[model samples]
Structures are given as structure tokens and as C-alpha cells.
Target: MTPVNPESSTLYVQSLATGVQVLRAFNTQRASMSLPEIASAVGISKSAAQRFAFTLEALGMLKKDSQSKRYSLSSANLESGYQYLQCHPLLERANPYLLDLNQRTGETVNLAEPADDCMVYIGRFSSLARLIAHVPIGQRIPMFCASTGRAYLSSLSDDAAREILERSDRVRYTPQTVTDVDALLTLVQQAREEGFACCHDQFYRGDLALAVPIWDAAGNAVAGLNLSVSSTSFTVKRAINKFVPLMLETARLISTTPPNPTALRPFRTEPRGPKEAG
Candidate 1:
């Protein structure tokens, strides 16, 4: 969990934070939950959960099932997300390039930005061809296992990367996931050497991803650009040989100018669940 800076603690509103947490309790895995479940998930009392749920429902951010009393995120929640995408300067600049790459590769293209120890998918362009799965915007993948995560880490100092790796839970999601901090650091080093990162079936079965970090004019790593392909469609060598150049070129084009430092931010109030991390 990311806490506000101690210096700004006086400015933080606990109620507002808790309200956002209540909304975040719903996800692809847990699409709908009961009041008791919400209370348990948010670490609040049942009455508190009920009040928040009631308020959210009234505000149209959440909807309650009349029969089951289960609450789920409403369409109104998309307003904030849509507004963010529309207003983000970096996203605005990257969309054309991302679309070009999507058309060129006919594969999944994503732009992910770091949020604490995770990388959140802020931009996603789906493949025209057959897809194994669909990952929506706002998806958070652990920095320890995701190719995008590793790519972003490669751009950071070794000590900075190690600190985040240590803070991670490091749960092995698949046979290919490198949970050991030393092993993971080695992968980051390899990315630094190769100028990109690759992962094969680390977070999802039959999913292979290659990523490169996006940098600003000042040389700060601001985001990661990645393309995901099905294992059935291409081997690691084929993917690297074919897509790496395209990925690098696209990233370079998008990084021509720096964007607002605060343009990209995470929307979640908590860390993503195991299945959600890739």
C-alpha cells in the first residue's frame, strides 16, 4: 500500500481515501461483492462499508443488485477514466504512434507507467488478429515479473530497482516467473544490456511480451512500451528479431518531447491481485 508523504499527512483526507478504496475493491476478478465482502476487503466496519456503498450508489459510481445486495462498479466510473485519457498529454502524443504500431504488428500494444512498485497499463491497443486475452486500461502488473516492469526497472539505478524488488511480494505466477530477487535483478541487467526486456509465459500461459522503456528528454524513465504476442504465433527469437526494432522505433518517436510529469498516474487504491499482475 502506498501511503501519502508524512509531510503532507495533514492535507490527506482519510474519508476520501477510504471512499476510493471502496470503489477499488471491485475488479475483473471480483466484479461484484457484498457489503460484508467490501468491509472485509477494505478493512473497514460493515456499517462503514454500507455508508460508502450507499453514497457511491447515489453518486452513480457504483450500482447495487436489488436481489443479491451485491455492489459492482457502474458505467459512471468510466467518466473519470475517459477524462484522464482525454486529458493526458503523453497519451495524446503517443496515441498516433501506438495506433501505427498496432496496425504494423497486428499485435497487442500497450503503454504502461510506473505506480509505486507496479506498472499500470494506461494505453492499450488490441490486435486485429486472434487474441488469447484482453487486458484493459488501469491493469497493474508487478514490476518484478512483467516485461514492461523489467524494462522500466532497467532504466532506473540498480539500487532503486533493488529497493522495489525487495518491497514486492515476489509470488511466482508461472514456471517462468523469476521470484528470486537476485534472478530478477539479472533479468533487469540483461534488459539494460540488450536495450529491451522479454518475458515468456511469466505472468500468463502462452503469452510472450517484449518491452522497452520510454524516456523523456531529460533521460528519466517515464513509461514502458510493449507488444504482446501469442506463443503459438511466434517463438522468442522470431519475436525479438521481428518486433524489437519496431518497438524501439515507436518508443523513440513517442519520446521526442517530454510530457507533463504528472500526466500518468495509477487509478487503483491497492495492489492488483495475482491474476491481474503480468
Candidate 2:
């Protein structure tokens, strides 16, 4: 769980924040945990962890094993995410475009938005071909290594992109992951000039991806649209030559359409640390 601000606004509910923290403790890696483990992971007392666990269970967001007493997230927990996706007009508007791109390229396509120092996948369309990486919706990848992240950064000024990179953890996920800030800045600059970003096996060993930034009517880069293929099938240059034009066209279409005001809320950045690359 992320630490809370000590000098937060008076309206802030610390208890509710803590409860949410407890819920976030469950992830793909640690799917289930005992009270003591949760307490340790969340930096809370065992009693506090117990209360939060029980409350979440009662709220139908979590489930506990009767025999082992280990807690795991319940299917009901996905309802919140489902509701967000259902109401998000950006995803609704971009779905057909992403689907078309996926069908045409026969590769995984994704829509992501910047959140602090990373890009979070909000929508995805998988290819008919075998997937090189299985990145689910809501998965976060560092800005320094992901094509979507670099594409989003390309929409910003160099100074602004540098600030984000400075705050990032900058962990080298693979041999191709560029941890050097200067090298990453060069990549972002190239993307800025080229109108798109392309990465080969940076985050995933066998994945090649290209991305273009999606802008709002006001010209702010509100999101990134990406197309990813297996490295074994196509070289990075070939993928870019094939799909970058299509991605740019889709981005232009989304930009011209007025976005639903309420749908923009979830894309807003919140304070959080970077996640280890998948």
C-alpha cells in the first residue's frame, strides 16, 4: 500500500484510505495472504489488518479460506473496474478503432494513459496469433521502458518528460531496458520527431511495439494507443512501417471527437511508485 500524506486535507478519510490499501495488497503475485502477512505487507498492525480484511470480506470485495484463513480478492472486486470501463467514453470511443487495428495487424493492441511515472493499460485487443505478453487491463508499466510511455512522453516537452523520468524507479527490466536517463531522453526526442514511438524487447523479451499519443481537442496528450507484435515474426522497423500510419490515424480520429468529461477522471495521475516490469 502507498503511504498517505500526513498533512492531507481535512476531508480526507484515513480509515477508508487504509482499507483500500489492504485491498490493493492482493495482486497477481500475492493472490492470497494471512493476516500477519497482510499486516507486514501493508505496514499496519495485525489487529488493523484483521479489521480491514473482515470489512472487505463483508463488503464482498474479498474472500477468506475457511481452513487456511488466508484472504484473496473476490470476483466482486472486479465490479469496480468493470463499472469504470463501462462508463469511460474514451474506451468506448476507441474500442472499434483498436479492434480494427488488431484484426488488420493480427497483433495485440492497447490503449494506455499516463499515471505519474508509468502508463496504465485501460483497454486492450488481443490478436488471433499467440500473444507475446499478457498485459491485462489496469497493469502499470514504467515510462522509461514501454513504447506507450515513450509515445506519451513524446507529446510533452523535454523538461516535462525528464521530470517524470527522474521520479521513475528506472529498473532495467530486460537487457534492452534503457535505464540511462540521457539515452531515454534521446528516445523520447526521436519519438517526438517521428510522431510515434517504437520499442523492441524493452519490457518483454520477445515483444515489439509501436505507439502514438492520443490527444484531446485542447491538444493535450490524454492517452497512448499501441500495437505490439512478437519479435520472432517481425522486426521493429517492419512493424513500425506497417502499423504506425494506422495508429496515427486512429489517434487523430479520437482527438477530433469530444471526450466525455466524466470519463477523464480515471486517467488522472495519482501518486504511486513504479511497478517491476512484467
User: Best by lDDT, which number?
Assistant: 1
Q: Give the residue spans of candidate 2 off by over 4 A.
A: 1-7, 257-278
- Give the top-scoring candidate (TM-score): 2
lDDT of 1 by residue, 110-183 (tens): 99999999999999899978676677798889988888999899887889999999999888888767788887
Pairs in clash, predicted candidate 1: none
Q: Which ten residues in a row have the lowest lDDT in candidate 2?
A: 268-277
| Per-residue lDDT over 1-278 for candidate 2, one digit per residue giving the tens place of the 0 to 100 score | 33477537677788998898888888778899999999998999999999999999999989999999999999997898999989988889989988987888787899999899999999999987688878999999998899999988887889999999998999888886878888889888767766777777789998878888887778688899998888888765566667776777777777755422322222212211122121
